[model samples]
Every structure is written in structure tokens, then in C-alpha cells.
Target: KEKVQAETFIKLVLLYNYRVERIKQFTNVTMGASTKEADIIVYNDDTCTKPHIVIECKNETISELEFLQAINQASAYAYALSGTIKYIWITTKSKNEYFLIDKDNNIKQSIPDIPQFGINKIQKYKYVYGGREQNQEAKKDKIKQQFFELETISEKDLINRFKQAHNSLWEGGKLDPSEAFDELDKLIFCKIWDEKIPRQKGEPYNFQIFKEPLPKNATKEQLLDIENKQTNDLFNRIITLYNQGKKEDPEVFKDNIRLSPQKVKTVVTYLESINLNITDLDSKGKAFETFMGSYFRGDFGQFFTPRNIVKFIVNSLPIDYKDKVLDTSCGSGGFLLYALNKIRLKADVFYKKDEIKHYKYWHDFASNNLFGIEISEKIARTAKMNMILHEAGHTNVISSDGLLQDIEIQKNSGNKEFKYNHFDYIITNPPFGSNVKQSEKPYLENYILGHKNINWLDPSKNECRDNQSTEILFIEQCYNFLKVGGILAIVLPDGILTNSSLQYVRNNIENWFRIIAIVSMPQTAFSPTGAGVKSSVMFLRKWNIQTTDKYKLIKQTLQEQIKKESCLKRKNRVSARSIEQPYPRDAFSN
Candidate 1:
């Protein structure tokens, strides 16, 4: 609502040439038995003796029905101040209606604009570029001009716009909710690309609608042709921009925009005038996250890790700009984004006076240090989009099972960054309660946790199990991704910590890593996102080669001692049985 009010205020000052002092905000008017506040009231004089125009504003997200109600409300205000008020304007940021109040006739007539100061006749259009004057009287008054540039908005406003645009696409049931989300993502990408394009001051953006003055005597067919041509031109321009972005980062999207030209225009209308590139990064990130969380929590909730948990885990780690980070199950890239933001905050402190340096410091880290792997292709793309919305760090995120071998991950994702023992830190909240069957995912056989019998003395002797829980495999997968002595902060179910049956799994963790800390989380921690299992975040450091070798030798010695003890017990038992059988045979002979 503030966005609408600010926009209306600007248009009144710059376009209509309204004197700032003559315009009053939140002016109260007497109703039947009480009073109500008008959003904006313009007076004919600086003393505010006579009201000239009364304006009512609503948020851009207001429904059409609600907007009409606002118009009626504005008309009531006009009647309350009947004799003096000449106009009633109802507006949202994207839609507007102007009226000329015929107080004597008790009628309200639609108009293109309320007349400007010292003008008796209203113009056909409030704004025109490079056009002849509409009338001789209008020529006497100087026309005030303003240009549209992409503007930054608050987080609440941004989220509202996102929700409003997304609803406009799917509310008619033309496209399913998921398809609408994909189309919206594509259009938002195009909008951001359009904003980054170089342009001179006062130059219009191609992403917005351009009104062309048509001839008065034009045929109906000509008008239809012009409208179709305009839509086609806009669609072509948007596609060109989208293709350009895809050319730069081929992995961001794998499909062209599937929305019709009209649908595409609908999305563009919601996004074109906002400058996402210049918006505060934290605001942008949170806005996208809040919007995305609501959608995914209903459809792909298992892939989402609550933001509070993500922030908690990330904050507890000693991550730095120089550290190479990975989220094995990077669902929507929440952990990676938090890590990136952590580094960005550091950049702010280190490069306090230099804006370019500040951007470069964090941007370099995001481009070079962050990596992720997600099994679901759709969720992986969502993760990539999330990263892009946060400004960068998406190039290394790939769509592949986190448990896949490094070579297989590389082959599947076409990104060579998924190397064993390479990342400096691994942070993830792998999906819990899902069993990965060895038959279904052949890669599971390669994980020690996937084995039914694990031979700690010699890993090669381990027999592969038919199935294993995904969270267990993720523990080992995160270990594989981290370098020796590197950190792993993973969310795991409480069963892994206390279940006697998973002792071997615990033993494997002991052999491979040095336990740092285990922070138990409440069962309800993830309830809001649809996860209800009891969980904890375990922080571990991968053992160095020397420590791992020492553990292997210790296990070997223990296995040898156990074998020797078993042989001794068998020999003693045989001797005792033979002695007892000899005495029985002598008695039988007697």
C-alpha cells in the first residue's frame, strides 16, 4: 500500500505539477456519526480551503472486486465533500481510474486524467512522448514529464508482487501450479536480464508495454493487427533476452518459456518496473525464499530444510570465503545460500568504503567456492534459481544423487567439481526416512553403509545390503566430499545416534571421522515444512590419512585376537567331549 501511495505521490508531483504543500496526507473527513481518513487530498490553494481532488490508493495485489469497492468508497468521499471536490481518483500501482465528479448533476464521468493546474479542459491522455498538442488551450500550459526506471521495493512489496503475478498465471486453471511457477521463473529471469542491459537515461525498457498512437480512421482489422504485432514484438524481445541468459549459463533452465504471449505479458506487467539487481540482497533473498518456501512446503516439502535450521547450522560452522563448501542434498540450495550470505557479510566489513571491492569479494567466493548436488531434477533447478536470485553461486550445483560416485556425478551433471575429498566444508539436511534400495540405486552398493555385513578389518570383505536409509548414506557421502580434516555438519535422525542395531554405522563414523559435536533438535523443528522426524545436527571432522590408517590397523589386530580366542575355545570343547565319550564307551562294553 505504501508503494502505491509513494508512486501516486510522485506522479502527482512530477506529472500533474501538483504543489507539494497543497497536497495533504491522512486528512480526516466527517462521516455520518464518526470520521474517516482520506489517503491523499489535494487542495486548490496552499491554505487548503477547498479540495480539488480526492485520491484513494490500494496495493497492487488488490483483487479486481476489491478495487471496484475502492472506487465506490472514493465516490462516497467525493459526495461527503460534494460542492468543492472536482475529481476522484482510485489507483493501485499497476491500475488506475480517474473521474470527473458532476456535483450539480449527481453524476460521475470517466476521464483519462484530472485537469492540471490552470487548465479548464482535461487531456485525452495524461502522458505522451514526442506527440503534437491535443488542443490550443492545453498548449498554453507547460506539460510536465517523467520517465519510468526500474525502482527498488521493500521485501513485503516484492513478495506481494511475486505472489500476485504467480496467482495471475495459474488462478484460471489454464496452467497447473507447477507449470505456472516454471513460467514465472523464466519471465523473472528475463526481467532481471532486461534491467542489466545498458541504456541511456530516460530510455524506455522493452520489457514494458509501449502504447502507439493509432490513426482515428484506422480500420478494425488494422487495430487488431497492431495489437497482435505489439504482443509478438514483446514476446520476441523477451525470448531473445531469455536465450541470451541461457547462452551464458546453460544449466539455469533446460526449456524455453511455454507461456502464451498474453500470459507472458501478464507476468511482465508485474515485474518490469522493479530493479531486482539493485534491490538489497538480503531483502531479495528473503523475499524469494519466503515465496518459494510456501509453495514447496505444499508440493515438495521433503526437499526443503527449514530456514531457521539452515541458518543455525551455517552459523555454527567456521566457514570462510576461502573455504570450498558443498551441500550433498542441496534442496533449494538453502545451506549454500546461507554460507554465501555469511561470506557476503564479511565482505561488507572488510571492504567498508569500496562498493566495487565489496561486491567482488563476495561474488568471487560465490562463483568459485560453493557447490551442491540434488537428486531431483526439478528441485535442483529450483536450487539453481534460488542461487541466481541471491545473486550467484549456482554454476556448480548439479542434478544428481549426492551418493553417486564423483565420476558418475560429473557425467550426470556435466560439472567436474564433484570430486572426492575436495570440499573444505559439507553442510546438508538429507531427506530422512527414505530407504534407498540397492537394486533400484546400484550406486548404493558402493557405500559401506549399504552393506549387510561390514568388515572393519578389511572394507573389501563387506557384503552389500539389499537396502539402506538415505540419511545413513548421506553421512558417508558428505564424508567423501570433504577433505581430510574438513568439517561435515549434517542433519540426521535420532535413530542413528541411539539405535543399537545401527552400531556398525556408528562404528564406521568413528573410524572415518573425529566427532566434533552433536546438537539434538526437537521433533517439531521441521514440522512447519512437513518434516516430523526427530533429528539432530552432527558436526564431524574427516580423519586424516594417518588417523584412518591407524584405525584400520587397530581393527585388524582386534579381528586377529578374536579369531585366536575362538580357536582355543573350540579345541577345549573337543577335548572335553572326547574324554566324556571314552568313559561312556567303557561302561557300555561292560
Candidate 2:
């Protein structure tokens, strides 16, 4: 916990903006007659605009004692700045905590001090071409001049090619890649690089099936090989990328793998797990219940939660390297993976280049930092695939009912390693629905702390038991999974927030958690559901709702207290993949 020096502030600016030349740090400047308002004030820009960002550092030993000193200093500067600005970000390197103070009324919300260059920023990035020729056409023509070769590639080939491109670009000198390549552009790059046989469209998207999906009458060895390939490939790619990125950016490796929303779907559709007789289960085409509820009969409904959404939730949580993060509803462990991504991102952003050599020693801080529990076999497998994809396949992702508090089975008859009270952060979008049976009622209680006698502990009365509500169970499960001071960010249906059905429970739960910011979502966000339902994303955290006054305050004041939002126009958002066609052509079929 070194004091945040002049150099530390410069690093923060660099992370925020990619095209930075240098930073000038100022020191203990005078404030009012009684005291100096800030430890440091940094002036920087995002290339196009220059804005002054004020930061207060805790050069003193950062125990719980110095938290207030840094915060108080930040508050004074932000209060003064807000008189003319919208927001100011403040942080302390020792504790690694960052928060944004709203200038209007100084609403201070603690944000995790993550790396400035995160996957979210990468997604928002669009490449700008510049050349001596000067002008849009010249810039485009210049980039186009470099090369364009479409290597007729399989999904596996696409990833490998990206890996090669990644390594090549890193070696070439830390360049930012343009928006990800389309099938056409990738081929063009290959051709420009002198690959004579680039594949063209209207042809096969090659299948490197690890294990052949044998015919209906196929034998056992045929099945075994398919299973082997699926599992082995799943394991290899994650470690390779993790190690590769470590060697490359080592600090910001996770920052480079950018995917748009559509690209996210592309990767998940390609992520396959060896499920025995999975196709047979779809014979009836019956809709089975999973976390997100009755998805399609086959693999249509399951996709990894997009990285941007995960990044949003991860940033909202109060997490650090020391905090034990858990995802009771870890879908492909997307949330956990992103949380780890944030931790690593912060380490890269804040620590010095030389200090970063201690990357491995931070493994335990990153490894044991997350935990996940999911129930659906497909989702669990998908989560495993995602964790591996994100290179956190090793971060204990348990395949079990998230709704169940802790369903004790025979724990190998002698496992003393299970600890119940270790988690510090929880972020997830648990399944949404209301048709479960009472047989799983106890699990929901354990899941969301229904029996904890906290004022927020409100379960649907047994008199009208509707255990069918997976969303309700998830709410409970998340509440129970957290330590007393832990935080959570959950995305559930809008109904759960304002639905009159569980007003009592909602009111009670409000006491145990604080509803931070609710980002109302548009309907088109979800797929066509076999079970028709509406959805919205909610962000809340665990704490006791001790008094009825606090409950009434949150309820009555929510609407007025919430800030109105203007939705981004279509052009700013990601395009739908279905408007054209999806990957694996006939892969999600028989």
C-alpha cells in the first residue's frame, strides 16, 4: 500500500484515454484558509476534449483509519467542482477504491477501481483511420491498402487466426485493432499477408468436430471420441489465451479481447459441450425449466451473457482482490469471469510496470476471488465453457441448484473444505419466471435468506405457495449467498421490482439491500420466448433494511429519486445477428 504518488495519477489518465502523451501532476495545493482541498488535481483529455479530473490520494498508511481522510478530501474538491460540472471521479491507490461524485447534488457512489482499459471500453471503440493524405477517403483507402484476404476459415480457424493476429499486432507495437473482422475482411487480411487460398462465401464453414456426432445407429466409440474432442478443446483454448495475453499485455490482456453484442452470440453458439443423448431429450420438443426459464427445446435459448452487461454489473459491485466473489446463479460463469477481468484490469491500470512482475503472487487473490453455482445442465456446461473461454475455468464454478442454499449431499464422506461465509460480491441475472413448485421452497429460502428474520426477508406465503417463481428464489439465494457487508448487481424482470404480487416481500427485502440504479431495458433485448414474459434489469446490494421508515422512503421516493434516461438511437447500438444469419449453419440441429 504505497502512497499514491504523482506517477500514479498519470497512470490513471493513461488508462482512461488511449492516446495520451504525458501527464502533469500537481501537489498539496492550498484550498480554504483552514485546509487544502485536494492532494492532487490532474488535467487530461480523451484526445478530443480536455477536462480536469481531481483525485485525492492517501499517501498515508491505508487502513480503515485513512479511508475518511481521502474520502473527505475528495468530497470537498468534488463539491467545489460540481458547482460547474457534472461528475468527478476520486480514488485511493492503497485501498484501490474509486467513486464518482455527481456534481449536481454530490451523490457519491462507490465504483470499483478497475483498469481504465476494460473489455467494455474496447467494445465502445471504433477505429479511426488517419494518413498523410488527409481526408476520410484517403484514410480508408490507406487502411484498405494494407491488405484484404479472406482465409476460408472454420469457427476454430477464426479464433486461431485472431490469436495469430493478436500476437502479430502486439509484436508490431501495441496497436489498437479495428472493429473485429467480418468473414470478408478476415479473408482480405489473409490475402494481403499473402495467403493464396482465402476461402470465399457460399461455401462450407468448416467443421472440426472433436467427436463425430454419429448417425442415430452409431456405436459407443463414436460417441466417446466426440465427447473427448469437445472437452479437450474446451480446456485448451482458455489456458492458451490466458497465458498468451499474460505474456503480451500481461497487465491488460483481458482488455484486448473485444466483442460486440452480436460477436458475443457468435462465440457462444460455437461453444459446444459434449452432452450425452442431448438431442434425444428434444424429441418431444417439450420446454424444460432452466434458470432464465423455458428456453427453446434445443440450444436456441442458451447464450453467454454479453461481456458489456457483465462489465456493468462487475463495476457496480464493491469488489477488490481480497474479496471473495460468488455467483449463485453463475450462467457460464460470465459474471465471475468479468469480475476477475475487472480485478486484473485494476491491477494493470494502477500498479507500475515493474511492480507488475508480482502477477503470479496475485493468483490466489484472483483465483479464490470468485464462486458460482448454477443448475441447468446446459447452462452449467455453457458457463464452464465461458469460464474456460475467459480463462477462469479454474475458479470453482459448481454445477448445482443456485436456488438451494446448500443442499448437503454426501461430501465425498470427508471434505472439510466447504466454507459457508466467505463470499464478498455477487452479480448475476438469474432465471426469470413464476411457476415453480413448493418442493423447492426451502432452497429459495436458503438462496435469498428467507428465514434470516431480516426485515427484507419476505417469502411468498405458504398459504398460496407458488414455488414456480424462479426469480423470487434467485432473489433469496443471492441475499443468502452474501456476507453481511457484501454487494450484488442483479438483472431481473421489472415485475419483480414493482409487481404487486410480492409487495410485502419486496418491501422487506428493500431493508436488507439498497436499490442503487435501475437501468430500464427495452423489450427487444430478449429472444422469442417459448414462455412469453417481460424483463428488465435491476441492480441491488445486500444490507439490512432495519426500519420501516427506510422501506417507505425507498418505495415512495423511488420514482422521483431515479434519474430519467434517454435511450440511445439504433445507430449507436449493436446490430442483430439474426438480420443476416447465425453461425454453425446447421449446428444447432439434427
Taken over the whole model, the C-alpha lDDT of each candidate is: 0.81, 0.45
Tens-place lDDT per residue, model 2, 311-382, is: 666776667888887776776565776677667667677666357444542455545666766665445544
Per-residue accuracy of model 1 over 339-446 as CA lDDT, tens digit each = 998998898788873588898899999999999888887788888888888988788998887888999889888888889989999998888889998789999888
The deviation in Å at residue 439 for candidate 1 is 3.0
Misplaced by over 4 Å in model 1 are 1-11, 19-56, 59-61, 64-90, 94-144, 172-174, 217-229, 353-355, 454-462, 559-590
List candidate 2 segments past 4 Å from native.
Answer: 1-157, 160-303, 350-358, 393-395, 407-421, 440-466, 527-534, 544-590
Estimate the Cα RMSD of every predicted model relative to the unseen true structure.
6.3, 30.6
